[model samples]
Target: MIIKVPGSLSIGQVAESTGLSVHALRFYEQEGLFVNAVRRGPGGRRLYTQDDVDWLNVCIILRASGMPLTVLRRYAELVREGAGNAQERLALMREHQERVTAEIGRLTESLDLISFKVGVYEDLVDQGDAAVRQCHGPSLPDEARTPDLRHEAMAE
Candidate 1:
C-alpha cells in the first residue's frame, strides 16, 4: 500500500524525478547526504519535498563532476548549518573549481594527442595497403623513431 502525502513525493516518485534508484536514494539518506532529514509518511515510508528534489539535483551534479562523497557530505553539512558558513562554503567550492579546471586542461591535452593519432591513421588509410602494411611492422627502435620537434620549438 502506498501512502499519498499531499505536496510530498514518495521514494519511488523521487527516484523517477532524480533518475536515481530507490536503493541509491536510501543509501544517500543513510549517508546523510540530504541537507535536511527526509520526512516520513504513513507506515514510516520516506516523504520528499520539491526542495529535497532540488537539493538532490545539486548533489547529483556535484557527484557526477567527481566530488568525493566525503567532500559532498561536507558541503551538505555546511549548507545544513545555514548562513554562518558562507566563507567556508566558498573556499570549498573554489578548491573544487580549481581541481575541475585542472582536470579539464589535462583532458584537453590528452584529446589533442588522440586527435593526432587519428590523423596519423587517416593518413595511413589514404596512403593505401602498402602504407598500412608498413605502418603495422615491428615497432621502431627509440633512436629510429622521429623525435617530436614540436617540443623543441616550444622550448625556444
Candidate 2:
C-alpha cells in the first residue's frame, strides 16, 4: 500500500534496523517516544527516515541504561522542539551520567571485594592448610572440606 524511497524505511524495515519489534515500534510511536513522529507514505503506511533510526538507537541505549520511560519521553519532546534548549538536554544527560558514574564506582568496589575473597580462598588451596581455611571462612573438621569441589575429584 506504500511506495518507499531509497532513504525511507517501512515500519518493518525500521524495526529490523532498530532491533525493536513491530509492536514495540508501534508502542513507542503511541508513547511519543521518538524525537520526530514517524512519517507516513502514500497509503498511510509508516515510513521512517535514517534520522528516525538513529534516534531510536539512542533511545534504545538510554532505555538499556535504565532511564525511565517518562524521562525518555521528555528528552524526546525537548529534542523535537528543536534547538535553543541544548542546556536543558545537557543537564538531563549530566544527571544520568553522574548516577551511572556512581553506580560504576559501587560495582567496582564490590568487584574488588569479591576478588579479595577469591584471593583468600585461593590462599587456602595453595597452602593446603586447614587451619587457615577455618580462620578465613570455614571450620576444619575431619570430614569438613573446602568449598572447591575439584579438590575431592582430584583426590579421587
Best by lDDT: 1
- Please give, for residues 10-110, the per-residue lDDT of candidate 2 as tens digits: 89887776779999999999999988878889999998988888888889998888788988999999999999999999999998888788877656654
Query: How would you encode candidate 1's per-residue C-alpha lDDT over 54-75 as one tens digit per residue?
Result: 8899999898888999999999
Give per-model TM-scores: 0.78, 0.70
Clash counts for all predictions: 0, 0
Runs of candidate 1 with Cα error greater than 4 angstroms are 1-6, 132-156
Error of 2 at 69 (Å): 1.1
RMSD of each: 8.1, 10.0
Query: What is the TM-score of candidate 2?
Result: 0.70
Clashing residue pairs, backbone N/CA/C < 3 A, model 2: none
Clash pairs detected, candidate 1: none
